[model samples]
Target: MAEIMLLLVFCLLIAAAVIFKEDRRVRDELRTQLTQRDAELADARDDARRQTAEAVRLKRLVVESGRSPAERRQLDEEWQRLVASDEVVSRMREAGLSPERLVTSAADVATVQPLLERGVTGEEIAQAVTASQALADAVSAQGSVSTLSPAELVRLAGLGQAAERSGKGEHDWPPIINLSEAAGYSFAVGSADLTPEFAERLRSKIAEEVVKIMGRYDAGVVEVIGHTDEQAMGKRESNLDRDLIPVLSGKTDIGTLSPADNAGLGMARAVSVARLFRTDPRFSNVTVIPLSGGQMVLPGDAVSDGSSARDARERRRIEIRVRRPEQPTQP
Candidate 1:
């Protein structure tokens, strides 16, 4: 009986040892899970705070005038400043969007967040923004956007479709026009120089577009954006996504400037276009903001689909958009 008792005690000790080992492993796993959860919670709090602040700013902006010319100009600048924030731009880049191509406002940034969260592409977000703005603009003359009737909404969509198709006096209605389609002259491969024929092309196609946009939208500023394909420039290897700050304070001559990659080349091209418009009497006093899209946008303002390889011709293009002010003049 004593021997039996000793064996039982020994068994108990082994069982205890097994339980202790299992407990230690389980405790370690729980600790790891706790750490992960804590980090997640912290991230959630940060995002919530940022979103709250953004909501407040948007409310204030909305309360401000969007119809008076001076008030509208101030609002445009405010919108530009908000969209130009690093966090917003970073979000755009993560979604394979070129921030340069986006005609952003405070509302656009807010609308983009939920779309990004749902894994929607930036190109889709841009389309949504465009459609939303069209409806909003139509309602401005009648009343608040919230009071838009169903028929008005349908009309806005119809107009959007019409704009997408053949627009009246549409020079570059799609915004993204292939150079081959828009320009008459050819540059000896990889050159941004606008020859006499190219100049005429601008005068006919792009200039006309600017005039129509100015007349129709009463826009204060016209942004000229340039894009190129994934093709390599010259014989050197280079990155295409680098930025070129617009030469706002001085002259931008296409003949004198030599850029390295597709992005730089695109900037030079856009600057060339801007310089052309600057001297034109039609665009006199009108602001032309040039931006480089490089090879970021595929045909039809779609974001690149992660393929470094494509029909190079389709991506070589230029796009334009107008910024409307509250009480905009001809410019």
Candidate 2:
């Protein structure tokens, strides 16, 4: 009876241990499943939010893309009203054409369409109209209205006129100085060297005149721009080799030296000129700025008279631009 009782107690102890281990394993598995379920729920919510935002963006795009027909019609009407204004008509007149003719004639459509397509806004068109009216008034006052031409139109607009000129068509601004006149200022042969006489004239006469002009205008800054001919750099085997070449080549850097050389020459010339003006006490307040204009602004080339050498001289000259200081406003 004692042995049977001890065996029964041992069996009960082993059974309790097995039941506790099974309960612990089941509890761990349930916790892992709950964690996975929570993660899945969060991921679904995130996906739904992203999908909703994208849908909103697409809907906005669709709404914006499909404008109402009525709105488009309204825009067209506004554009037509703007183009049909008296201001536009006046601009056409200033451009050397009758406004009524421009509107009625089919030939005028070609001209109007191009100006419109060139990114000229309605406001610009209106300003052009005003300018045209002003020019017409000026011409009428001068009693030269009959002499008006497209070249005159460009002059009134403060723009460079086209090359061609026809009687009764247009009048261009007269050349400030012809190439022959400009060339007569100095005789500079090749290689950036100026004759002593030329240098003296530039320093004494031109520089002195510029100083007097600046003093007369009470200008604070005088910009001295240097221009040059379109000549190639380096020695050539023939005169034909004097044509311009690209600044860069894989092997030699002779052309690269051209810019520096040109710039130095320009600076030296400007300094030589400035020295004359600086001698005067009246010009002490003015500042001089030297700049190289490269081969730009071929002023004489506007008239193609087969005088390239003469035109080249006009290109190779100096310009003086004056500016004044901004005055402070008094309260």
Candidate 3:
């Protein structure tokens, strides 16, 4: 009986040892799970912090963008004022006037108003009168009375005379003639080639007006300048260097061009317009120079101040200017 009791106690001892081993294994597993859970929580916290920071940064940007610079505000105001009424623009078009001419007239008014309010000196008035008389004499000689005021008449005459006197108008340049998109000189998006209607207008309306202006000035070079708005052009391979000559020679179409940037696009469009002038019989003796103004120049010959970012039709334009050809270098 005692032997039996001793064996039962040994068995209980064995059972206890097995139970302790299983308990230790379970505790280690729980500990491992807890540690993994803690690591996951830490990662989640870091992610939330990053997300919050990004949100704050984006909100700040939004607020800052809403507040435009003072110059930008001023530019916006000027643009609003200079923008012509659609009805008036239509009337001017019917009168065979360029829409940009309206802007010029408005700018002139804006400039003169401030000067008039400050009052003109007697000396200035006298000079203006003499200039006007001189202009009238010239008009009378041609059997035509100018519709311009005596002052305006003289200014025009002076511009012409100044050009004529400056080494046969080689030194002095004439006012730039802006052919804005507002004047129906529009292009397809991302295209440098002129549409059929665009080409027709250039040959018929624009060329005729330009010829008349050139007649007024002793010009030997016609600078065709292309201007673009401040829209960002995405990355693209440029074909200008490889294809410019071919495009000019009619070996390739201008429509196939892909400019990498605004500057190249401007140059390509300028070249396209210049090609037309180069081919025209009227401009055979004159050099047609193509130029790119890019997005750096604003209307009224001001440098862009980063005031505008929207798509402005008025900003995308072609400007024609007349100048005397450069004199050849003496041998």
TM-score of each: 0.41, 0.32, 0.48
Return whichever of 2 and 3 wins on lDDT.
3
State model 2's lDDT. Answer: 0.57
Q: Write the per-residue lDDT of candidate 3 for residues 250-273, one digit (tens) a residue.
A: 688888888888888888899889
Which residues of candidate 2, in runs, are more than 4 Å off? 1-182, 187-193, 235-268, 279-282, 300-311, 326-331
- In angstroms, the error of model 2 at 193 is 4.7
Best by TM-score: 3
Q: Model 2 compared with the native: what TM-score?
A: 0.32
RMSD of each: 33.6, 28.6, 36.9
User: lDDT (CA) for every model shown?
Assistant: 0.71, 0.57, 0.83
Clashes of 2: 7
**Candidate 2 local lDDT, 1-331, one digit each (tens):** 9999999999999999999999999999999999999999999999999999999978866765686878657766886898778677777778888866655887757766788899988689889989989877887787654477867756855522222422111333221212122566553543334456666765666656766555544457767655555554344332112221211111322222223343443443444344444555656677766555545445543423333433355556666666666689999
Once model 1 is optimally superposed onto the true structure by TM-score, how far is the C-alpha of residue 240 displaced, in angstroms?
14
What pairs collide in candidate 3? none
